[model samples]
Target: MAHPSFSLSRRLRLSLVSLSLLACGAAWAQQAPSSATAPAPTPSGHMLAEIQVIPRPAGTADDRYKHVDAAIAVIQASGLRYEVHGLGTVVEGPPEKVWPLLQAVHQATLEAGAERTLSIIKVSSGAQAGGPRVEDLVRKFRN
Candidate 1:
């Protein structure tokens, strides 16, 4: 049951459900009944993630961009496989390195003088062994 104080309109509920299905499709979505194959064992700590850092520094658009750049610089220096997309930067590595790298990237924005910041991230890992790779998902799309 939903919280009585937090009810969503029917239309909004449907939209949220749709979005949830898309977000979880690879990991948790229901699959068609099949007997030929079984799911892989639990994932390793390897990950592929997209991180979006929004720095709200007291400054003009260019200044805000500079803060974002600061965060990207941290990403660039980490030496992880990464690609800067329009909304976020995608990074791939083992969890040990990626976790610290995420913290450093978030802190970079504040260190660059952002009053406050918001970071959004989406992380996924392969079902089998080995670290996830950005190329695994986007290589075909790239061409």
Candidate 2:
């Protein structure tokens, strides 16, 4: 017979593995390609993602700005539509494209001499045909 503690630990491990698999499956489902031949659909609607990258550099404040500028350069080159705000940048695209671009942005910050980095991200997905756009959301409140 197994020890009680060992049995409980085994159950916990199994539970964690199950949860991890379920999470991965759900994520894959969202970005899965419609067919084997064609690439994943850009999903007619839009998805909005906001990302803020904070880089901790060893030098002065200017060093931090340098990292941010590097990240912005990556975003500019990504070709996904984006708007830069005071605190963060908002990007609009399908999940398949936006996710990879965000990753690239983070990596660019690190390559720009940041010893450590923190990335805060927010994502909103819409089911509507055109999806939600940044302009539309702010237009209603503007004077």
Candidate 3:
């Protein structure tokens, strides 16, 4: 996962550092304090999507983030179980709800004034009535 050529903002850098620290701490779980608690259990029969929206700025120096906010607003009102992270948002719900929500998020970003926007989404579903959830995968890395 070497990406030495890319430049990220200070906020993004700090967030990455914070996430790395949490992961490193999890790797040393044998020494974790007894008071540490695991993440809540995952809800069953849902799909998962981790999404990031990249909206083209007005110019080389523009970073107003109006478009980003627009996309998040749509997600916020989606009535699904979700968590907003530094790099992306994790959303979980039934397939019927999740798919359209993602589309609306992308469209909202573009409608917010981005000449073009890119939405990177990673989706996962399980074969059984239930599947892996946000809490299931990140429980080890979260308290």
Q: All candidates' lDDT scores?
A: 0.65, 0.66, 0.69
Error of 2 at 71 (Å): 0.6
Tens-digit lDDT track of model 1 for 1-143: 87775457633422221122123334333334346653333346778777877666423565636787888999999988888765578777787888899999989989988889778777777666764355433333454
* Cα lDDT, model 1, residue 139: 34
Compose the digit string of candidate 3's lDDT tens values, residues 1-143. 54665446633642321132243235544344334664444556678887777766522346466777788889999989888786778888998899999999989977878789777787777777666556555656675
TM-score of model 2 vs. true structure: 0.63
Winning model by TM-score: 3
- Put down candidate 2 lDDT per residue, 106-135, tens digits, no spaces: 888889888887777777776665454565
Candidate 2 Cα errors over 4 Å, as ranges? 1-45, 58-64, 127-129
Kindly state the number of residue pairs that clash in model 3. Answer: 0
Q: After superposition, how far is residue 114 of candidate 3 from its true place, in Å?
A: 0.9
Query: In model 2, what is the error at residue 19, expressed in angstroms?
Result: 32
Give model 2 RMSD, 1 decimal.
13.8
Q: Which pairs, if any, clash in model 2?
A: none
